[model samples]
Target: MVHSDEYKAKRLERKKRFMQQAKKNNVFKARRRNNFSKRPNFHNHQQENQQEQQFQKQDSTALRQRGFFQVLPTDDLPQVPQCSHGPCLLFEKKNGPEVEETFFACAIYRNQAEFCDFKLTFNKETGEIEVKEAVEGEEDAEKKKKKKKIFGYNRIPKALTEMSPTDTVLYCKTCINVFPNKHECVCEPVEREALERPTHLLPPVNEQHGESQFFFSTETLDVITKAVEKSKVDGILCIGAPRIFENIRALHPEKNVFLLDYDKRFAKFFPSKQYAQYSMLVDHFFDKIAEPKLMEFFDKSKSILMITDPPFGVFMEPLLKSIEKMKKRFVSTGKEETLFYSMIVLPIYIRKYVLHGNFWMSDYRVTYEGHKLYQHSEKTIVRLFTDLPVECIDLKNVAGYKFCEVCDRYVTERNVHCDRCQACTSVEQGKWNHCEKCDKCVKPRYVHCAQCARCHLYGRCIQKHDE
Candidate 1:
């Protein structure tokens, strides 16, 4: 008898579930077995055998020495057993005549666990041992320069000079540079209430948010101001950072600045007309753009400029999806541009993200006022990724900008000035090839595959081999 299609489908589903469960159980069992194999057994036969041999050797040595030596007795002398191992210099003071008066110790320098070869000199008079690290010579600096040349740009360039302070513009304490004012100094004295406000006004400290809500420095705010003024940005959409929205609004009150955040507390800071709460994690908010409430918040006619500091640990997918939803509402027709500026606040960990043709990185190290979660008194270094080109701003003693030959201007980080191609390309670490056919430089190791009639990644196209 043949089974019905529905019945067979249900049967297949049950079989698939059972197979998955079986596979999971097998993996668990394998892991358990591997863990058990790694554990050291206390009653190991080999260790016990070694101990037995040691005892036997001691007994035989005692027997051989018994007939050759005579025992001596002294009533005043303290009993001391001979050391089985060779005389250890670490305990030498205890064996000497001045044993009662002197102390002895031996420690691995700089907390090194293995192969400690450095000799530490001990002063008997002062009861101290001094250890100094070997000095780095001029050769070390030359080696560093050589390493920098491999990347085609200096990590620390000589061209960046210190800026002089001016009374006309307010200089950031962290960045130590006057705010650039082509028209007028947009910098205003922050109110005492705003400065003294609770840190909770920012995003909450949580794993999902990466606990990374830090206030931008005065200089960084100025940089934002310059970008806004230069691009003639009319509408601002701030995600996750309400403070940034406030700053932009204060600078350009005429511009339409809106704040979109997951937290409801941000609404108190901004007007009812400007602030809208939207959770990125919620599929209804991020995925649904046609919703009346969301549509009302985003206007289609205006050119929107979005600025955000997304959670570093969270994948870019959710953030991108949220941006897509916003763009659907705010993006205008014709030659109007929608600018996106994102901040990735992390230490020197290299993260390779998918970068589109529109994306351009900033060279300036954005200084951030640390929160309770980060608890750093000093401002943190943040990398800004933007679609708009920002004028190169350098922090004192920090190499933040690089000269781009193609753009005829100084571009930001992760951008290379390719001498061979005679253009500035976004190729990371200055790695690229000058494609003769394309008459341009291409990133990511692409080779000319004649059979494919285009350039493909090295060894990727099968048609090239077939040709």
Candidate 2:
């Protein structure tokens, strides 16, 4: 037993030695494996390093291309696409040192014996027009001087001035009606009263009242001008003779203009049917205005360029049907007389619910000719007709112009009235130069309107503003 026990102890010691040697070898192999894996020459290690570097570079680039680094409060961001300035904020606000003259021109048909509705709203007892003292801002002081000349007011209207609080008889020109205040009488009733007057008592002729129609700001004018200039059409087809037509006419006088409305009085205003020919026809009615008259006048086949602000509800369907009929006529007549542009300023619901048709997009063509030689010719139209990245239509033929492989396409040049240049619009945005009213940077490349006190760069800048 003693001999056996000694042999077993010797064997056990050998076994322990073997296990220690094995453990040491295993540690050495593990170290070698780790070093080999981390070596830069290996594909896995090099790939991992390259991937990490690429991810880091990508992350840095993403951070660099952000707008408004700090998260603005929810309220600060403009919810609706309007003058970022909140409600009534733009209407009745005092101008600062940076803002120039707020000498805004407002037109009133004096014959209507109605008090100023807006004036009456503030002071319930008095319908008197408030006259405010002019501020000492550089822009305002100059504007105040202009106002004195045009409005004949010694000072700007900041508080009630024209009439006394107790005086109930407001002496407007022709249509006289006693009202608690100007705001008491609705706009429709006031307009009706003015219409009743054979002739307005205060006669402000076209020449004298040139600045009366200057209610549209220079910024609004810029947007309208851009929309008109960018528009690819032979001319504009104005449907309703609503108050908006006056503004449209003032905005785009260069294009061939046609107007159709049920109101004979509105059409009668354009004597000799000169600048804009108005068709006084009333047959079919849908909304408040005539629809068939507009559709019939829309027959000048080369695709009518329509832009109007129609009333909502009833007028929507008739207008859409008229548009659809017009579109069908173009499609069925074996001529692709596509509606070049239909820029309706009214609500989209009125367009869809009332018009009752899909607004299909037609291809637009944009092109440029030699500036000097083709200076007084109709602007070339480039047709973007493809669904891919960039597709457009080429204005190869209109009425009689035939395309020749050798000399390209040529047409007899019309008078200089139709000559147009391809123009682009850029809205302004910058630090320290934001419009106080709109709170947006005015587009660059536009000349600032000293009179209107905003930026404007279009021929239509000097159009009529009188309602």
Query: What TM-score do all the candidates reach, one by one?
Result: 0.42, 0.27
TM-score of 1: 0.42
Candidate 2 Cα errors over 4 Å, as ranges: 1-221, 241-244, 247-252, 271-301, 328-335, 348-467
For candidate 2, the per-residue lDDT at 142 reads 51
Best by TM-score: 1
The prediction achieving the highest lDDT against the true structure is 1
What TM-score does model 2 achieve against the real structure? 0.27
Residue-by-residue lDDT tens digits, candidate 1, 158-226: 111222233222323232123422214334433323521223233344433233345666667676666
Backbone clash count for every predicted candidate, in the order shown: 1, 38
Evaluated against the true structure, the overall lDDT of model 2 is 0.34
